[model samples]
Target: MSGYLALLGSSFEFFCLVILDLERFALAGQPHWDELEATLQRLENDPDRGFHDLAAAQRFHYLYQRAASDLGRLASFSAETSLRRRLEGLVARAYAELHSAREARDTRWRPLVWLLETFPRTFRRHAGAWWLAVAVTLLGSVVGAFLVAADPEAKASLLPFGHGEMNPSERVAKEEAGRSKGLANRRSSFAAELMANNIRVSLKAVAFGLTWGIGTLAILFYNGVILGGVMLDYLRAGEGLFLAGWILPHGSTEIPAIVLGGQAGLMLARGVIGWGARVPLGRRLRAIAPDVATIIGGLALLLVWAGIVESFLSQYHEPVLPYWLKITFGVANLAILGAWLFLCGRGPTPED
Candidate 1:
């Protein structure tokens, strides 16, 4: 038993060293990728080892398998370092594929659906900081709402924007009514317009991620403050129940989707900023391709959902259901999103 334990410890140590070595090479200006693959292969040969050696051995084996499979992709190319170069080729191919898919009558929906399926995992893996920012913003809004609700006098000036004497909520109602009337003639166009606006906003959130994420935070803060002010206004009007009708109907999906878009922006930004040292151009592109695909794909899904909510659900501003029922629907929406984000297993990361 002592000998077995000793062997297990040594094996574990070796396994760690192997991983560190691979990581180091990957971070180094010139990655010794072939060497990493060789090490993984050797580790996997230790079949005689028992449970104690399982963890390290399995890791090495997995890395080795991935490297082998990825490296083998070179057969399709005539260039040296074909696997890496081929990955660099992704930008043009992706753009063309997506564009062509959209233009082709039979293929338009397929490309969009593909993007929806792949983007969440990438965003989830690379968006830790941005996601935290979103969480903080949401939590702050909730707390601020409760505070305003407690003592109206304490927050008499809570809403800073002017309603020109109509009061905040009344102003909003008038504006909303005007917008609805303007949109009455073109429902499909309105949905498309909203979808385009949402996509543009989400893309900007991700694109600015290249700037160390400060830009993303600024955008999120703007949104949070606006929401907090609206909540305060609603509570002030003694219309908490009515507010639920306005928000809970479609906000359940819309709000989360916006947050998710922010997260995707952060992920893309990390790649642009070289989360690890700038990789070989080929290696870098290969590493980040899947993530780019994920962001675009996720936005497509969000647009569809947002269109449904905006066109159908949001128009019905009367809370037909009881408070508990509305709350339940809100909870259910969050639960489904949570399952997709954290619980669902897809490859090693969400994007895969």
Candidate 2:
């Protein structure tokens, strides 16, 4: 029971983290050499929340300095130069900073590593709250679906939250409905395009976690409800079982990762809100960062699985196995998620 609580808490935490960071990352396109360094300095100077570890703080500072210097060289490139030359240098600096940070974990901040290793162990730590979060999300979804089902006009409105300048669903629908030869091949031929679309959708969902996690519990609640409604709609249309068959294989990997990404956003939110809680900000954030990264990294892997599912598994027009087999696989998937949460490692400190 304790382990289950911990997993629930961790899931909530990851969900919050992704929601908070996504918008920021998109608008700014990730921290450049100078920006990341500035963020570190800013974090140190924060009155409510500052770095408790000097070595970790200094290491980030050093990385920023190197990044800054590299950016300086890149800035000198002429406008006529292609992007490959400019991006290569920037990419190298980012990787270097990331690697150095990882190396410092072993030498300067072993506790940070221990904390990360121990995180999955706490799967049962906040069992009550974890269950509550899921319940709240589930209830919200049920209500949202009820509202949509109650009104045919509102159904279209519930399609999705459009990012960027246009609606992706609308664009895709148009492309698929067109009569062009290009569309013909996409419909009847290769799987690459389908894989690409799946990847895009999964990434968008993961990215949205940043907003859902950081904005507020309301944001997370809304996303949960939206997802529920979408799935519920298919189920009502007698496609529920078929949709489940298509989604389960990849969704096993995809959905949890998105939820985890949301946890990351929550981490950022906790940092910002301070929750009026007694804990120091630095420690709280440090605990949150790695977990956030873990989920984000997990999301990337899930996208790959999603591609496979979309390209091949979902393409299966007929059910290939018995109903029991599908149920077994589905249960197995949930069990694996459960095990990952509880059995991985013990938490470093009992309290967050």
Candidate 3:
């Protein structure tokens, strides 16, 4: 009986040593796993551009295969259950990333095809989030319009650059003159500036979502207030028609892009806030990252188009182009955008 007891004690000690050795091996591989994950994340975020990094791709492949082998060894040897589970998850993720990257590489125009097809489908799938963002912005705009209309002094606090001091007529006159002198004279520079500004605003809207979405909402609301106040001021100055023509030309595309940016922020907020608690927060964030990139890319393209219209077509008032024609063109452009987004990619295809 004493010999049997000694034997049991020795076996327990040996088991402990095995655990320690296994732990050491796991720890040794952790940094490589982390580096592989980071590279995978970068590739996932911008798959089209990321595939160009051949070194990173090779590194990921090496680490992934190594991880798979480790996982197999751990499973076969009956390693600690916890460590085995972790390795399993790591191997699964690496496999998915490797598969996706390989598939993307197989299709040279996959990015463009995704933009044309998969992107719209993805956007439509999240239409509820987008519309919610639009509703918030519109509600803010209405509140702003009512406030400025009810209390003329409110404009002082709302409008930027002391523009509130100038009555509606002065504001309209200045805008008209600026458009004529700046946009008409230096179209290229003006377009570039406008595009840059819009891009900045859109980026801010998306970035601020990291703060649990409050920052994004605040930005959208403040911009809405400024727009509403400006519009009311113009209408009060009896330049309603002028304001419509001035804004609609570019506003058609620009407004939707801004709203989409807000939507992206809201999605980020959803992940950070862990809305459903069904999935792990980290997984939720990973799932949404690609969608956020797609939305931002679409917004950038839309802003470019808007900048062009604002710089060229919108500036041509009176004899150069009638207000009626501008409004018609704006409506037509919006219709085209609507059709492209909702109907263009409905055919039977994997991307669609």
TM-score of each: 0.53, 0.49, 0.70
Measured by TM-score, the strongest candidate is: 3
Tens-digit lDDT track of model 2 for 281-323: 7766666565555544544555565555545444343334443
Model 2 shows how many backbone clashes? Answer: 41
Better of 1 and 2 by TM-score: 1
Error of 1 at 256 (Å): 1.9
Candidates' lDDT values, in order?
0.56, 0.52, 0.80
Output the TM-score of candidate 1: 0.53
Could you give candidate 1's per-residue lDDT for residues 262-321 as a string of tens digits?
776566556666656658645664576656656666656766777766665554443333
Model 3 TM-score (2 dp): 0.70
Highest lDDT scorer:
3
